[model samples]
Target chain A: MPGTADEGFYELRLYVAGQTPKSVAAFANLKRICEEHLEGRYQIEIIDLLERPQLAKGDEIIAIPTLVRRLPEPIKKIIGDLSNTEKVLVGLQLKPHH
Target chain B: MQEKDDIQQEITSSMRNYSDIDPAPLEKAPTGIDGFDDITRGGLPRGRPTLVCGSAGCGKTLFGMEFLARGAAEFDEPGVFVAFEETPDELIRNAASVGFDLAALSAQGKLAIEHIYLERSEIEETGEYDLEALFIRLGYAVDQVGAKRIVLDTLEALFAALPNEFILRAELRRLFRWLKQRGLTAVITGERGAGTLTRHGLEEYVSDCVILLDVRMAEQVATRRLRIVKYRGSSHGSNEYPFLIDRGFTVLPITSVGLEHEASDERISTGIAQLDAMLEGKGLYRGSSVLLSGTAGSGKSSIAAHFAQASCARGERCLYFAFEESQQQILRNMRSIGVDLAACLEGGLLAFHNARPTQLGLEMHLALMYKTIRTFRPRMVIVDPISNFMSLGTQIEVRAMFTRLVDYLKTEGITAVFTSLTSGSAIDNLERTETEISSIIDAWLLLRDIETDGERNRAMYILKSRGMAHSNQIREFVLSERGIDLIEVYTGPEGVLTGSARLAREAQTREAQLDRTAQLELTRVRLEHKRHAIEAQVAALHAELAAEAAAFDTALKAEQGRDARFSEDRDRMATQRKKGPFAARQGKGE
Candidate 1:
């Protein structure tokens, strides 16, 4: 693995339409996964699409809760409340797929 | 847009008339589509969701997009297009093909197009979720334009995105209700399923109205049809109408027209003055469907050209549909007959539509015609050799198309002149006039080809003309460098004669008349000779008698002179004749 200076840096955006329970769960689950995977190198930004609904169109968001990886080299999106940490790890590329 | 303004006004006004039939009818949001409003009695139910389902490539998306575009542009109601199958750019480009300026509409704040793309690979169903963000986007788009109409083109994409059909169906139901509560007229499209109206049965959700678009192949030709599956709280035309997406969605309703069009009493010439004289000294009534049917090369097109020329001469726009010939060919042929159609073409008073009927389906041809007629705004339309369409479809389909065309032209108050070709070798041999169109046409002019005396000639006669007096006499239809002329045909014991045979027959009659006069002159000379000879004989008899009497008198004078000189000689006998003085006085007294 070619590890550069910002290789461990993580920039994540979490899109939620208002304060729904699933969005909160998704946020909590995503934060726990990132803390366990690489705690000190991650940055999380939360966006409420209800107050600014037009923002959802900018990132191709449709589900209630979505996590978009804006960091590293490739972009990835994981929708719904991230209850399963294994799947979230796989979606975020913290671990390979089964 | 300007081309459709007057026609839409006509449709909506008629729609108002239908809604007025009841004290209070359900209010409708007019789609402003050409014949679609006429079929829906007004339009889809207002402020309610309608389901539009069709198979792949069947124009369901176009229908929805058009609904939104028309509502936003024509009805003054803004719209939001929620596209699931295509992106906003794709939607705009596809709409441009139909002449709808969606991007301009969006810029004018009259439209909003949003693309909802959810990739199944990226979407992870980790926990419970609802499509609330979708609602937010929809609401944002709607509020952006304050739209009254909305279209969710192919919401079936949600099934692929989400593994739960049950949740999608529930969300769709809720979505429709939300749309209804927002008082937005919504159109949600879906793909066709086997034995189902839609893949997920969206009909169960949007219950206000349901439309089914079908594209089926009939004998290797693809035809598109639209049927109103159901309309709640309203009655809609149930027939499957053939539609075409030429410049826009034109649903050709086969037979919904009534016979309530006001008959115009104005008259126009048929361009040939002699033919006009034969037609009750007037011509075809304005806005009447006039038919000129004849065999090939029997001057049908020539006469049609004449009619077109006359219409253009009166400063009316004419649209000529030549199914059998190219425009240049018609122009050239008409020029040979001195019908100056080239001038009319240059004057912008004439337009030509030349296409083989087999090049496209009948519906496509009719749609192109509708689009052209709308744009050109002609006062008169000439379909030269309308019989060429008979080869394109079955008699019934052709009749349906013809009926629709005739009805449309009549409704537009444009005079329609149709030239048809009879198929028989001899026009007189035709068993009957065209069984397909004779019933609907108001005036029928039959052209015939007469072959006699080793020469071929043309003739024309009126078969039928309603609401006016038309000449039934068959006149020899002649085309010369001076244009068409209806010469008085010779109809004697030799049957109807034309061409040089008529001239020969007329000359023969004149020769026979001269022979009869010459015979009468000879008989009068013989009678004069007999009278003069009899008079001379009588005079001779009188002369003979005078001579005899004179001889007798001379003999008596001789006897008296012989008596006077020979009275010196006859004095002897005249001495007795001297005594005849007393005797003569006595004889005189006797």
Candidate 2:
């Protein structure tokens, strides 16, 4: 079951095309942040759009290295290799300030 | 040909193997800009190369840089910029002018910029040479800190280095495939050719999307336009839209139809009361395009100056594009109309860009106008004698240029007033060049020099005004030391009063006829009034005579009756001599 909004939880989907260096970095950066902050309260869904090209439309994908926050009421998206964890976390609406 | 075929076979087989092991789709990259993703049909086909092609100075490189900068700053998606033209330092400096903090992004370990220097003269192409070195460098940069967005400032220079067309084509195809395989959304810039869409024809075929930029001159005006030539698997705006590159490397797409944005309905005074009256009430609507047409010395410049003065007085900035006169000359001439353009210039509310009509091609002129407008951001623009551009090109070119300029002005929602010189005799009729521009204008004012009886008289009339009720009568205009004054319409003659001689003759003839009619009518009325007085006197005299006659008749009848009575009394006295004294005495007593 998806986490409730009252629980202060998040469900993030990080889309990657392949094992490119940028994709691998994005995965690593996201895992590090989620483990440090989200702990067991979040679920990270890794979607490989290249393997199933049709799935790109499910979230209306155009570019790779994009992060989609699915559990939030207002879905948020961030594109690029997730080198800047602060920008990615803020873009995905996972900021601790909130 | 056999060797080329073998190379092509090898490339195709390698692409197949690469695709067969296709990676998973990554997260959606949001550019965080409004309406841009919609045009791309979902941000630029994720990790695919999109080619933006245009002629020189058409904002192709700017568009790519903006995309990369936005990705790095807004999305935190580090970007790799590989420039085949400008150096990294120059690129960073130029981008800084547009408000792109490239250095900061690079220092943050999210962005990498590399300048690839290639000399066509020094390069030696070996048969075994592939773009492997470029791929390696790009890969190393992308991997060093990881870049999600890659921008190749130009692909044409790289293509130019490799002397063989077959090799260039194959290498480009492989480059695109590799970018996709690496999951990088790339922006590639290409130079436009005169006949073909791109300098390297292979760019159009290899990219998932294609955007073409055009810098053209219509009349003598330069305009930069952008069009989506092809967007594979996505719908996009197909029309050529005018754009301006301003601060922040911003590309403002003008002429985007179907956007339901409401324009302001405020009216700005033209400052000339008579001209304002001619416009219906007071002045022109804000954001309206006004076309003022007149022959030589018809006070067209004076009227345009008045508009500019009015706009400046209202604290709104005005841009005056003068093609025929020097800025100093214009200022001196406008002083006669009480317009202190020098003051406006000094105050920084007005700018005058004066140039010869033939100084540049129509496109360059338009580009200059676009650049100036972007820099100044004026609320009002005046192009005195726009018809002069006709001397620079054919009528068709002028017409096309005017169409684009008007469309751009309308899209900007700016008040634009342009003067066109028509022949004196052809007041309502437009000149050949201006005839083509008349349809796109919102309002048209025709000024004519009416020559009647050797007198030249100036008159202005509003031929047409969309969405307003304007005066239909031709108002008399006078250019004096104070300014242009519009007087009541001259109704002296059937013919239009144009020249001073004709106007004077018509005035003389009209005054003569008016005096003659006034004298005749005065004489006739005076005579009629005398006749009426005489008639009234005669009627009174006749009434008095009739009353006198009645009184006289009454007197005569009374005297006869008295005489009869006296005779009767005498006869009675005689008959009654003995009783006559008594009867007479009784009658006297009675």
Best by lDDT: 1
Top-TM-score structure, candidate number: 1
**Model 1: per-residue Cα lDDT over B1-590, one tens digit each:** 55235433533443444342324467899988777888899988888888888899999899988999999989999999998879889999999999999999999999999889878877666666777888889999999899999999879898998876666777877798799889999889989876567777676676567888989786566888899877767888988888888777888666637677778999899888987887788988889999988877898899889989999999999999999899999999899989889999999999999998777777767767877787899989999877777767887888878888888888888899998878647444243346788898999888888998898899999998898777879999788988988898999997999999999999999999999999999999999999999999999999999999989987997776644553244444446557665664454343
Docking quality tier of model 2: incorrect
The second chain of candidate 2 has a TM-score of 0.66
Deviation in Å, model 2, residue B486 alpha carbon: 1.4
lDDT of 2 by residue, B345-453 (tens): 9999999999887877765577568768867999999998898887777777677777777777766778999999887665444657347788878889988877655
* Residue B61 in candidate 1, Cα distance off native in Å: 2.0
User: DockQ score for model 2, please?
Assistant: 0.01
Which portions of model 1 miss their true places by more than 4 Å?
Answer: A1-7, B1-25, B264-266, B367-379, B408-414, B426-429, B467-470, B521-553, B564-590
Write down the lDDT that model 1 would get: 0.83
Per-residue CA lDDT of model 1 for A1-98, tens digit only, reads 11212446789999997778888898999888888786798899999997788799888887778888888757778877889877777777777666
Q: Give the DockQ-based CAPRI class for model 1.
A: medium
